[model samples]
Target: MPAAANLAVMDIPTPQEALRKLLLERLRPLVETPGRAQKPCGMQFRGTQLFSYCCFTTERIAAFETLQAVIGIVLNGTKEFWVGNSGRRFSAGQVFVLPAGTKLDVVNIPDDRRGRYEALIVEVHHLPPALAALPELPQPAARETRHDVTLTAELVDALSHAAHTLASSDHAEILAEHRLAEVLMLLRNDPAARCLFDLSLRERIARMVVAETTRTWTAEAIAAKLGMGASTLRRHLTQDGTALREVLATARMQIARGMLERGEANVSTAAEAAGYASRSHFIRRYRSIYGAVPSEHLAR
Candidate 1:
């Protein structure tokens, strides 16, 4: 072959290819020998927003709601999402951003040829100071909206670097937050990215509850912290077709679910972290919301 043909044939991997390779190399060991770590489904950086998701079987987890906005990159399988009546499928190397408080059904299907699925997920909760300084931020609709993003090379590299940093460094929270901010900036122009700037009342309350799950949160206390009257807050939430109890329950369940997924805590520990003084109460509530007890869930 000519020199030019040889150079073209030996070209370096693209950003998408690089990301796929990076995730597979790092997460393959964890998936193969799950007992080596506490993780059963995937690995999570406790203090950071980064996490890995792996699945060998096709299971549809229905009505999975996002307590916080998240961005996910599919590395080794097809992730199918059903939001309301609409359905969409994202394949390997694709990215999707879901707004906070959105409810959807999701299924993880391993790659037909590879026989395994892996992905990287990052929760976007911290709004950068500069972005929050904007005077007029766009408000998303009360209903859920999905942002199917076309990742640029810069974005792909940012995600790859974040995964590497979190996986290798013991003290990576500050750096991880900075990297998360970079991700938000990259997708700033996209409509879905506005969730970080302009949050709805329900989502705002959810974020607060999730931040301090152990707190004995009451409507009056939450209202006082938000600088609003208790009655007024209740009125607004009522208008939104929810109440303080519902919000608190959902937020607590989200924390408990996260703890269980990480596999670092037992059911009792998760229950306490979720502010449930009674383990029985926590199990009943979890079953009502997630359709299974935490123990049964862990078995999966």
Candidate 2:
């Protein structure tokens, strides 16, 4: 070979060849899955409890609280994430069940073969309206362990179909709502999925109120879902050392705080979503609970 050709071959480093190929291949699964036409890079979800979808993000999120009860699925890479007090390592194709207003400490979003931290997050604001008869919930025989580590395959499939048929943004929004509701319905009803849910009456009702923050919630309606009368429900909550109004207020503020942290909603938007008739009242209460005004979260 000529001297120049020898130099050219030397200049091509072999060590990084695998990484280069891996980087290039990252663009392959742009859609949620195979046999579909999507660039995975730009897919977005909009809907009911599962609020929105995001492509991979490099943004570092530390000890930030989740806006509402949320369902997060990691499509690629590993995530060191926590919901409430449970801390565990989550791998790809795993699901996360974060409690409403749970402070999430995301240790990090790993950069790996799957590219940046790629996952889907849906904020749950509303659960299905109560059925006339709830299934007979099993009493706790021992300590009930919360489970966030569940298979993400079914969830990934449902979300994939939802995104594949996304027409308009408006349509996308509607699609998310029904599909998420469907998923929640399935989780609530599936005997096998019982461990993945938080079954405490207060916690369950609190999640429901947070999911439907904009609507006026009544104790009677919540009581119906739990298969009890309003007075009995109140008595139960009282025994649990909480009240219906307290749960609503806490859920609202936590939801607003999460929105503020992500810069997704303005102070006013958050207030409205949290069901405050007056922005001033929202601001005062937000500061009292979260230790800052809503807008301050963005600045922080």
Candidate 3:
């Protein structure tokens, strides 16, 4: 077949594309108004799983540090990302997976027709039991990269069901988890998303701590939460070369830094948001990690 003919043939909307259209339509009620706020805004689904609706009125570039792994689907417009030194682009009908603790900048460009950029950001904290029980994935080299994959019908359907159930009932957490699990299981089979499946113990703990940054987390408490002995959890984290204290600090700092950057809170407010009681202590710790006071972010 001729190249032009192939393009014509492929231009037809796949079943996935059709379902994505319906999903976006169903989500319109929950969509935030563009330009109302600079920060991403949306709803939280199940525990630690967030399905945020991000809408930007104008072309905007922002830096983000992920505290948990995210699966983002662009519902409108396009996104260009720079991870480390590599660049990648994804438009409507595409999916991108970012691992926990990744620092990257992205430019969100609205399509001329829509005049706004829209996307759904799903924070995936941990794999479901079915996926977790599978064979462990090989650890890749220490490099920052984003996984790009074609959005599938199964994922769209799962999201649609999850959204509908949440909107209709007060007790929808269990049903929503099963639906989102289907979404994750689909991603697990994709080669590009294999990195997401290999979240380290340190990363998993980091994700959990960040969810409730205000809590005073002890090793025993965290271990009990994870269904393991305190000493055993400590040993495993030690093998990963990160201690519980360090992980907790890193997670809290990330939250404070993010809030400051978004202009949502001042140093004192951000410190409290990150679970700090004393302003001076938060400032000292912030300076130690970022080499600047929390006030510096406010200055921007």
TM-score list, all predictions: 0.68, 0.64, 0.73
Local accuracy of candidate 3 as per-residue lDDT tens digits, 38-109:
545333332325455445455445565675677776777888888667778877767788887777887787
Superposition TM-score, candidate 3 onto the true structure: 0.73
Per-residue lDDT for 9-51 in model 1, tens only?
5678987667656655644443244445433455444336666
Model 3 gets an lDDT of 0.70
Regions of model 2 farther than 4 Å from truth: 1-60, 82-87, 129-133, 136-156, 162-178, 185-196, 224-227, 258-265, 272-281
Model 2 Cα lDDT, one tens digit per residue, 89-120: 65555556765555667754545664655656
lDDT of 1: 0.72
lDDT of 2 at 194: 50
Which pairs clash (backbone N, Cα, C closer than 3 Å) in model 1? Answer: none
Candidate 1, RMSD to the unseen true structure: 5.5
Better of 1 and 3 by TM-score: 3
Comparison by lDDT, 2 against 3, better one: 3
Error of 3 at 86 (Å): 2.4
Clashing pairs in 3: none
lDDT of each: 0.72, 0.60, 0.70
**Greater-lDDT candidate between 1 and 3:** 1
Ranking by TM-score: 3, 1, 2
Off by over 4 Å in 1: 1-47, 56-68, 112-115, 126-130, 139-146, 192-198, 212-246
Best by TM-score: 3
- TM-score between candidate 2 and the true structure: 0.64
